[model samples]
Target: MSSRSPAPPNAAPNARAVLAANLIRLRAEKGWSQEALAFECGLHRTFVAHVERQARNISLDNLERLALALGVQTYSLLMP
Candidate 1:
């Protein structure tokens, strides 16, 4: 038999990409600019852009702040 391990069952998809996509959609839905969202989240606009692009790995605390700014629960960001 081959040595490769079997893939785990019911593994979650990538969290960062899911979060980024949700953030982008929510911002668009609200008609808010990245700068505006960042301000509301107490974060830098550039950082928000990076987060939305999934170029930055955001911490849980920052994710919570962004979720709160978007008027959503933190778990919403992780939704598919």
Candidate 2:
């Protein structure tokens, strides 16, 4: 038998969760710290953390800021 554990059950889809996961993935792929991304986005580090944690309902303007900083379209963040 394989040593790897079975995949966990899939959770229900959520917009905020999708955005948060995409943010983490993109940031890691770019080797950027949350602080670095915040600087690039012209937002506070704590605010970026909150968004990553899905602790806040991110605003459209901020979404645009993040997309611009990440060099992606805003809809990319919203996509599943």
Candidate 3:
């Protein structure tokens, strides 16, 4: 028998969550604090924290800035 159980309503992974998880992982891999990354990206430290926590809906321009600061492609930030 299949072990998989159906997901409840609204249980699907959202883009913000995926982005948050990826951002957290990448930031940790680079040994950067949210403040440090924000400084590098020329953004407010609180903004970075909000993004990492999936509390803000980031824009495409901001995404590009983050990718450039991190030396990664913008699309890389969106991948699962």
Collision count for each candidate, in order: 0, 0, 0
For model 3, the run of ten residues with the poorest summed lDDT? 1-10
User: Which tens-of-lDDT digit does each residue in 1-80 have in candidate 3?
Assistant: 43545557878666777788888888899999999899999999999999987778899999999989888999989887
Best by lDDT: 2
Question: With candidate 2 superimposed using the best TM-score fit, by how many Å does residue 37's alpha carbon deviate from the native?
Answer: 0.3
- Model 1 residue pairs with clashes: none
Task: Give stretches of model 3 more than 4 Å off.
Answer: 1-12
Angstrom error at residue 51, model 1: 0.8
What would the C-alpha RMSD of candidate 1 be, to one decimal place? 5.9
TM-scores of all candidate predictions against the true structure: 0.83, 0.84, 0.83
Q: Is candidate 2 or candidate 3 better by lDDT?
A: 2
The order of the candidates by lDDT, greatest first, is: 2, 1, 3
Tens digit per residue, CA lDDT, model 2, 1-80: 54544545895557788999999999999999999999999999999999998788899999999999999999999898
Compute the lDDT of residue 8 as modeled in candidate 1: 67
